[model samples]
Target: MPYQIQSYFLEIKKANLQKLRKDIWSDTPVPAILQVGDTRNNIAICYRGSYTREFRKRSYMVKFMEPNTFSDAHVIHLNAEYRDPSLFRNKLSLDFFQDLGVLSPESHHVNLIRNGSLKGVYLQLESVDEIFLKKRGLPLGPIFYAVGNGANFSLYKKGKRKKSLTSGYTKAFGNESDDKYLIELVKQVNNTPLTDFPRIIFKLIDIEKYARWLAGAVCTMNNDGFTHNYALYRNSKTGLFELIPWDYDATWGRKVSGGIMEVDYVPIGGKKTNHLSFLLLQVPEFRTLYRNILEEILETKFTVPYLTNKITSLHQTLRPHILRDPYKKKEIELFDGETEVIFQFIHDRSAYLKKRLKYLKS
Candidate 1:
């Protein structure tokens, strides 16, 4: 069974409330108090995400200052889930990755109330910060958030529309000096030839782990994952980086903005020169590994029957809260329609991948 859904109440001062509302346009943290059922704590709350924060019911990042907050975790994430009406995209994606033996942030559902007003149902996720790395026994190294529209993992210099690789990362942990490793990784990807890539790529990162992460993103049709909304961390023990998926509310055959994506849409950067997918797909061995990983996921973890049950359970659990949500962005009827769309997407996507498997091998 999935974890039990939780409800939280927040009491924000009028002045702090005003600051938070303004801070949505700009990324800033405001001091506030948080109440979980009966327990109270001092926390710093901040508006998080790019386009999603602009919405009325915003997503947030919370830092619990005092110890023993939420079982030794200091930071947690609350996602507004406006784009994904089903409200289970993040949970389902994270669960799928774990089933495939990949590490991802754990997530659960929560009801948020501010100043006695119901803000709607939000997805509460474990933050991937220093505390998270410690709990996972991952080495304390540089942690980078792949942020912004220019976060496309391509070696593009700062130009009219693109931000350079150096400027694209927001370091959450470790020293700024560690960025030299990141710079070297980007150079190798952009400058190396396909034949030479295999011999040298493993020295910079773990190819097997990366292939699994890439497979997860492609199989789920998460168009944004290749570029943005990921966390890259270097392991102090191995001195290699691993990828963690983030902000998956846009997945399951939908764009980040909730637009419909075709079931047959291939997320591989087919001809794009700079993106990682473009470079990786060019290698025959890597291509075969990606295809095999996709087959494993579609066969075992991401099957239609399995995902259908997930959508059904989460819908039933979130229905009441979603309907009564005071700050819901869309009508309840539309949300109902979205649930059906999600169901059909799972079934259709499975069939589509089964057919496309032959082409991938060819």
Candidate 2:
């Protein structure tokens, strides 16, 4: 057996899926549980809405296996040895994101056992406000587009509006009107050799826009964002953007060994010496802008406390599991200190960038 009984319970607290059944074949096909796109495990999304203040009055969309639901879904392989791991992973990813500052849809654990056999693991996630390209517009997508030198974002021709704002240095176009400003920023990010000497000192950086992005970055790392993960959002008709993160099973500062967090920071220095700082250097103008933004926000009473409380409150009941094997457990240890690490990181970043980008100011 990959793990004993008690070991399974602890792992159950932190993992995405629960242990259900092991068919003689890995593909025996249970009718209830299914794979979730978020975890690549068999799953389903059920009802989600709103209830409490903490969750921004939003209800979670759940992933579960209901009886007799598989025929409609594309059949996929499940672990022959146990329940789905997605049960534990998604919530953990949310907890981390909320604490770190990325806006994640609400996530909760769903316990459903057919006749008390512990049949399935369910993830209740927050419903995202999507401005469908065909119906509305996808402006908010570029908010998390990770714009910089050498970064590439796929342009959707069909849904995209396809009107240019700036040409030559970079091309800015969106499939819809809502996407106009967002796409303009991402597409026209290249350093423009201005005709008149950058008339305004803070003209290059939009503090508000970058603050929103910095908050989102904290959410990304907490979610253990993978290369493919993207924050999807919608710029509501009201104009305020609604952002939600959708990816997990990659974070929590846990490596199989917990040796160290091996983050590939943006490259910096020069042509010969590349570094993670290069990500900032690519947008040197933005550095202090966000610093000022962060400062202004911190002065207000609304920031930090909500995020701090959210992560702390959910740390125990909401921890997700990281499986050593798809169907088994070696047990990953939980570090409560992740919140402090993240906050300190953002604070230090604000301080550092303020000094670094001071040159851009008058």
lDDT of each candidate versus the true structure: 0.76, 0.33
After superposition of all CA atoms, the RMSD between model 2 and the true structure is 12.5
Q: What are the per-residue Cα lDDT tens digits for candidate 1 across 1-362?
A: 44466779988899988998866766667878888877788888888887777787788988887543766678899998887767788888887777776669988889998888888899988888888888888778888887754555565634453445565678878786888878878878767887898887767777778888877776677766766678888888897888888888887877777789888775442224226767777788877887888888778777766777777787778777887787653477877776678777877877877777775663
Candidate 1 lDDT: 0.76
Residue 35 local lDDT, model 1: 89
Q: Once superposed on the true structure, which residue ranges of model 1 sit more than 4 Å away at CA?
A: 157-164, 268-274
Query: Residue by residue across 1-362, what tens digits does model 2's lDDT show?
Result: 12111111111211222312221213222223333322323344221211111221111222334432322322111111122112233455555445445455554544333222443333433333332222233443323322222222212223443343211112121344545654444343323333321232124333344344444443323322222233424343434433344544333333322232333231112111111122333444444554454445344312345445544554444234323222223332323445564345444433443344444342
- Model 2 gets an lDDT of 0.33
Angstrom error at residue 152, model 1? 3.4
Q: Give each model's clash number.
A: 0, 41
Local lDDT at 132 for model 2: 27
